[model samples]
Structure formats: structure tokens, C-alpha cells
Target: MGSLDELIRDLRRFDRRKEVTNALARKVREPVPPVRKKIRKRAIEVLPSSGGFGRWVSKLSITAAVKLQGRAAGIKLKGRRKGFPDKQPKVDLRRIDQGRAAAPSWGRRGEGDWHFQTVTPGFFTETTAEADEWRKAAVSAVDEALGVIRRG
Candidate 1:
């Protein structure tokens, strides 16, 4: 019931839709990262094992503080409760636990491909403030590494 011009326009619209759909399907079927190989090489160069500008920067260190409170104090003098001790015990100072940072490693491959495993150092602080300082240093290191990658 439509005019001839309107019918032609409808057909053209359908054809355009079909074309777009086919194009999208083909694109989806293609390999992703069109430049995967290049990216990989760049990533390697930007992230090296040691003695490189990106080496220290790419490492992430996260430090956590842990508070360890001493046990409860017992009652003073004897003849108290059955569970009570003769004297009140002194409480030990709370200690802080510090975390260490290391590089994240991808799995190793045959033929000279090496990986860097993450190594966490033992706690080194007795206070939360010291632990926080270590954590901030780690974050800064990671940020520096990201900056290097972006520049590349």
C-alpha cells in the first residue's frame, strides 16, 4: 500500500542493516588485540627482570599492620577465685606486623623464558604507623612502573 519510492527506501534500509550485521560478525570472528605480538614485545621491554628503568617501578609492595594485644591481667593477692592468679601480670606492648613487596610472575616457559616470583619479606615494624609507611612506599613503586609503561 506504500508508494514506490517508500518501498525502495525500505529495501535499502533492510540491505544496510544486513550489511552492518555481517560486517560486525566478521569483526567478532577475527583475532583480538590485532597487535598482540607488538604489545607483548613492548610489555617485555617495559617490564624487565633487573637493572632497567622499569624494573623497580613495576614492582608493587603492599604492607599491612597487625596489632597483637597481650592477654588479660589476673587479680592481685591469693585466695581470690579458683581461676584467678596470685598476682596481676604485666601486659606486653602491642606489636605491628609489616608486609613486603615483590614482582608478580607469569608462568615460566621452556627455551630461556624466565619468570619473577613474588617474595614477601617478614614483618619489620612494631607500630601501625611504620607499617603504613612501608605500604605507601610500595604503592609509589607500582605507580612509577605504570608511568613508565604509559610513556612507552
Candidate 2:
């Protein structure tokens, strides 16, 4: 039979993996903020949570080593269904301190201004540049978690 210490070590490994997943997801989504305005004027204000890309990306799940998969994709990301009976697509805006009721002027009803635009290629370059740093931080966090396990 495995010792109690072995079980504890296994649990710590699982925790570390979860932490790494979160870190990777954060890194993947880091570009959304800056890319928002570039993608469209007032994109940060008009769209909930910078087009809801950041929030969607933040929900990314660990699919592979040091990598993640999320709902935000293509030129558009269909968000969660909202409204009691209407069941309309919801935009997550907690990141920007605004709710659906505060849609931007362009986003108001009857505006007919909602259009899709692709993210600039430069955004990917800028975000990937910092990937190493994010990874390092995640590694550090894992080390800390493991250290705590060891001490305990």
C-alpha cells in the first residue's frame, strides 16, 4: 500500500496542474484588453468586457501541457444565454464595471451598428511576448504549493 505521504504528494501535483491551467488561460487572454480598442473604437466601452473576449478567455480550461482551450474564437464569440424568457446571448462585463443595462451608445437598441471585426495580428505578437513571464510565474506558484505540501 502507498504511504500517506505518497497520497499527499499526488494531491499536491493535481493542485499544481490546476494552478498552471489558470495561469496559462490568463496569459492567453492578456491580449484582449489592448486589442479591444484597436479592433473597434469604443470596443472597450461599447462591448461588454471588451467584446467579452477577455471574460471568455478567462474561462479557458486546460486542454494540454501549458496550454488551454476556451469559448472565445473566430470574429465572434456567442456568450451565455441570458434574459429570462428571451434567452438572448449575454455579454459578460464584470471586467469593465458595466452590465448589460449599460450598453454603449453604439450598442443601444435600434443602433444596427453591431459589426464583426478580426483581431489585429499584432495583438497576438504582443501577448505571446509575455508568455514566458506568465509561465515562469505559474511555475513559481507550483513550486510554492509544493513547498507548502513538503513542509506540512
- Model 1, 3-63: lDDT tens digits are 3233223434353434433343333323322222332333234333463412332221321
lDDT of 2 by residue, 1-152 (tens): 33323433454446455654455345434444433333233333233356574334334221213322233311121113232233224533222223223233455443343443333232222333444544444445445444544565
Evaluate model 2: give its lDDT. 0.37
RMSD of model 2, in Å? Answer: 12.0
- Candidate 1 regions with alpha-carbon error over 4 angstroms: 1-19, 25-34, 50-152
Q: What is the TM-score (0 to 1) of candidate 1? A: 0.20
Highest-scoring model, lDDT: 2
Evaluate residue 83 in candidate 1 and report its C-alpha lDDT on the 0 to 100 scale.
13
The number of the candidate with the highest TM-score is 2
TM-score of each: 0.20, 0.29
Model 2 alpha-carbon drift over 4 Å, by segment: 1-9, 12-113, 121-129
Candidate 2 similarity to native, TM-score: 0.29
